[model samples]
Target: MLALFKSLPDDGSYNVGDKLIGESAAEFIDDITDERVVSYYDVDELLEDIDLINESKALLIAAFGIRSSIWRPKLADAIVDGSIGVPVVPLASAWSDFPGDYEQLTSENYPQYDRSVVQFYQYVAKHAPAVSSRDYYTQKALEGLDISSRMVGDCAWYDLESLGEKMCKPEKIDKLVVTDPHQSQYFDQAESLMSELGGMFPDAEKLFCTHGDPSQSPKRQELASNANKYGFEKKDVSGDVSNISFYSDCDLHVGYRVHGHVGFLRKRRPSVLLCEDGRGLGFTETLGGCGFPAFTRRVPEASSTPKKILQTFPEGTIHQLQRKYLGGDRVSHPTTPARDDVVDQVTDFIHQELTTGWHRYEMIPAVIDETYEREMKPFIREISNI
Candidate 1:
């Protein structure tokens, strides 16, 4: 939301609509800190009510869940049917799962179970004036579909501009915050890493915070208990902005949540993102630092090769594969459907981060800054035209 405002001209005005399914009214109030937002409406209200559409110059869909099965088709239909007359734009959009290879998608090679995924992107490519992807991976994935897009770093990175003064690499771990892994299967690895970190900075005040509510996820609730066992004080930062603000005050973070790592980095603080999925890997690859794969060593020997695994279980979703092999729980909520299971590379990056401090790798932040500029340039230019 902040990124959209930051991209605009000083006098530019816009209304904000949120499409997040489970988000509550109170949460929205807490999350939206900007006064410049002219009005707020539920995504349904924004889509159904033509009055809101008439008042808008463009409809910009902002941030994650851009590749969702539920909403993508609805948005695509609205644009195609002329219900939405204004230019449609998607800013910092990303695939929930990384597209492993780029080729004409088909039943044999298409990674996603839903064929509509590519169709949705194709529709936006034809109808929308501009589309901005969150990472190089997402850009490459879209390119395979012959859809041109600008590779804008995630909108979260733009929060750095507002937080530049406060962002810094701490010399000592005076305070620490950790966001744990979402799955029970990864808990042992997460705990081992946390134990090592705790030993390294015994005196640092530590707190465990969740990106989502623990009450909703059985695994997350259990993870919170493990954090407390490690002497971490459990802190509930329920709001989106509040979560980032909490991390900004912390000296360092080592966690499983992608946004937690992003929150810390935007504040110029050091963080280690335990890459359990493509989102973490994508962010790490884009910034050129501060992430490690928690489950690299856990993949069975027989299906270790990424290509072999994909070929053997072409239709097997992330959830299905994880349950069969990794002892992951089957949950009611829809997870990010992915084709790739392998964590690209396992390295000593985490060790170096915890031992030497993240600032030593000066090139990482420089790369992040460079990417921000390179990606945002095209996005700004395209959005201005809209």
Candidate 2:
């Protein structure tokens, strides 16, 4: 069986940063599946590559942050076209509501967005055999669209068992702050928080980290510039290996990226999440009991300062959150479902779906070769003015 895992763009051009969700999902699936696993950058490429599509038994949409309306159309299209030929299994993903306003689903406010979501789910229900999401809220969002999905938590959480017990607060401040370039609006606030943390922990070795490509992001460049000014150092954490390596030593993490926060948690580091959107808030709320603490961009009127918000959670609170969330002692809460059985269940489902007589088309290699020559020679000649 062949498994194609959808990943972030791999075009020669640089991307913002390597997405941890895509990387983690691909790694986890690779380890567990007997099928040969391959990674593709975009859905369009997957749709166009008939040879790849024809050979694959399963396609895994490695979407870590899938809850936004922006993704609805492409996902819907993938479901409609791809499912006709092969089984598409979306895994370890979450749905996002608009930032700060948790009560409002984007679909309710944006009619076109709602339509896209509904259409996608309608196709998913008819075509795709199974789907999985990161948390209960995302599952409910899918259910709202009349699509059934398994709650597997985030793929990152699958490694929790290996992280050992939760850790207590460190004596000295060795903090790592993860930042996002897209959220420019919050840069001032984040800088303020960093300044406050610096004042509090004079001897603290605060570092500013990013999971994305710095070359592509103005916000990242700006953050890097301000790092020295705020008495913090800048670190680029673009891939899974770097993430694991960097988080291995940090005592505390404060960041806007959900996966960045999860990376810290996976290493049993105490973390404070700076919530930017639905995915951020949902992830924190879902796993808050498990040990994640978050403050939304929309700070309360009373706590005007972002640093003050961080101060609200004392060292004792941080320790408790870590123990409860990552310590392995706590039971699976409703918000944060246990992921112990997800890998086996998802693996079994993929195997079952692949073997259940999914349609396959017989292609003549000679015809493909002839077609390639027929299509490419003229195009090359035209471009060359031959």
Highest TM-score, which number? 1
Q: lDDT tens string, model 1, 188-258?
A: 66666556667766788988876555665567677777776776877655434534455667887777777
lDDT digits (tens) for residues 48-129 of candidate 2? 6646765666555665345434353454565576543676666655675533234544345432244765676566546555
Whole-model Cα lDDT per candidate? 0.55, 0.52
For model 2, the stretches where C-alpha displacement exceeds 4 angstroms are 9-18, 64-78, 82-84, 105-114, 160-169, 217-219, 239-244, 289-386
Q: How far off is residue 48 in model 1, in Å?
A: 4.1
Q: Candidate 2: give the clashing pairs.
A: 16-213, 17-212, 17-213, 67-95, 67-96, 290-325, 291-321, 291-325
Q: Which stretches of candidate 1 lie over 4 Å from their true place?
A: 1-41, 64-73, 98-110, 160-167, 297-312, 315-360
TM-score of predicted model 2? 0.66
The positional error of residue 64 in candidate 1, measured at the CA in angstroms, is: 5.5
